[model samples]
Every structure is written in structure tokens, then in C-alpha cells.
Target: MESRRGQGSLEYLFMIAAALVIVLIVIRVLSGVSSNTPNQQVILYADPENFPTFNTSDNYFVYQTTVTKIGDDLYNVTFKAIAKRDLSHVKIRATLMCNKKPVYVGDQYLTVTDEVENLPKGWYISRYWSPIRRDEFPCEVVLYVWVG
Candidate 1:
């Protein structure tokens, strides 16, 4: 009879241990602690394509990229362009692309408008967009430039 009592006590302890293990798993899941969590950090980058071709095709390059947080999940991005040859009436516009898709803030796409009438060779020009919402990490800036 004593052995039967001991067996019952051991079974009770095992059940309690199992319950604690289940509770721990539940807590972990509720806290959103996991290895598969996606990274939400944003990184701004410059596109290397050099779109809207200029006379000195190989001379245009994006020399710098800057990103600053303006609000929750919102950022301001700036890209600086370096000119290798004389450029005049330079008009530049930029679009924000996240994961190869354009990022929209409200109902419009995020963009920037900046122009330099005379950019001499070896000069740098910067264009920026403020309060751009980013839904994904590692976004790129695409620039469309015109020179007259």
C-alpha cells in the first residue's frame, strides 16, 4: 500500500513539471521572442544604375547616402551626387524603393525635388526626401536627372 501511495505522488510531480514546461512555452510565444523574427531596421542605399543618362555617362555617381528617423517607421533619406564633368541646368528627382518596390507615404510615392543650375566638374549635389515611410528594411534611392 505504501508503494502505491509513493507512485501517486511521483505521478503528481511529473504532471506539475509538464504543466510548467507548457506555461514557459506559452510565455515565450506571447512575448514574441523567437529566432525567426524579421528585422525591421531600415537602411538607406544609393542605386548604382545612374538613370536618365547624362553626357558623361561614367562620370555621374552617388557618393553618399544618409538616413534619419523622423517618426515611427518613418525616415528622411538623402543622396549626394558627384559630377565628374561640367553640368548645367541640372534637375534631379528621387524615388524611394524598398525591396525593389516603390514606398508610398499616404497616397503618394516618396520623392524629392532638387535642382542645380550650374554644377561644375568635381562638384557635389544633394537631394533629400523627408518623412518617408518605410515598410521594409534596406531601401534604395533611384534618381532621375536632366541637364540642359
Candidate 2:
């Protein structure tokens, strides 16, 4: 007995296969898809604003504030910050953010001594404050570090 698919059925099957291939191709083209590997990131910081959005994506620390002082008519914010890379050649700078502006407190150079450079290879100034202003009393000082 000779068994063969009818012409109509064979044509229908071929048509269905062609339609499936065409649909796949159209989907691929429309999606504009190409294989991309995900990048690995280290979560050095975890905060709401630090969640990869406002970041410039350059592995830099986002400027943050910690309300170090909440006085009667002032708020002193001390921001704890460090350089991203080890042995970072940095110039220490202080800024007091009171009314949405940065006021520089002069630049301080790092003088690495035997006790500082040899034992701990880190540069940090714990308390960097601006000089007292004559026109201000009980003023708020938002301490921040500027990496250069």
C-alpha cells in the first residue's frame, strides 16, 4: 500500500511552518534583541537615593548627609565619606550646606607620616568644619567631603 500526504494537507503544513518562521523573524526584528551579559556590581553602599539611578555610573560615592546636629535654630549634618579606591591621592575639602549651596572651607593637603601611611593606608579627616561666621549664631553646618 502506497501512503502519501494529500496536496492540500502538505501545502497547509508548509504554509503553517512558513508562517511560524516569519512570526519568529518579525518578533526578533521588532524587539531589536541581542545577547547582552549582565554586569556585576559591588554594593558598597545601600540607600534609597543611592540605588543606581542618580548615580553617574562611574563607581563614585554619592554625596550623603547625616544630621549630626539638630539645634534650636540649626541643623548640623556630618557626612562620613571616603575615597572609592585604596591609596587614593585626595585633597581634603569641607563644605557647609545650609541653604542649598556649597561654601568651601579651604583645601587641606594630606601629609602622610610614618604612623599614617605605613600602618593604615587610608586618608580621612574626622572633623572638618568651617570657621565661625560673625553674622551667624547657632547656625547649621552640613559637613561634606569633596574628592579631587
Scored by TM-score, the top model is: 1
lDDT of 2 by residue, 1-148 (tens): 9999667988989999999999999998865542121122212221122221112122333333333223443333343333345533333233343322323333341111111221122333333333323223222323222222
Q: Write the per-residue lDDT of candidate 1 for residues 57-90, one digit (tens) a residue.
A: 3345435567677688776666777877888877
Cα RMSD, each candidate: 19.0, 14.7
lDDT of each: 0.60, 0.35
TM-score for each predicted model, relative to the true structure = 0.44, 0.29
As a TM-score, model 2 comes out at 0.29
In candidate 2, how many clashes are counted? 0
Query: Where does candidate 1 stray beyond 4 Å?
Result: 1-57, 69-75, 99-109, 131-135
Q: Model 1: which residue pairs collide?
A: none
Q: Give the distance in Å from residue 18's predicted Cα in candidate 2 to where it truly belongs.
A: 68
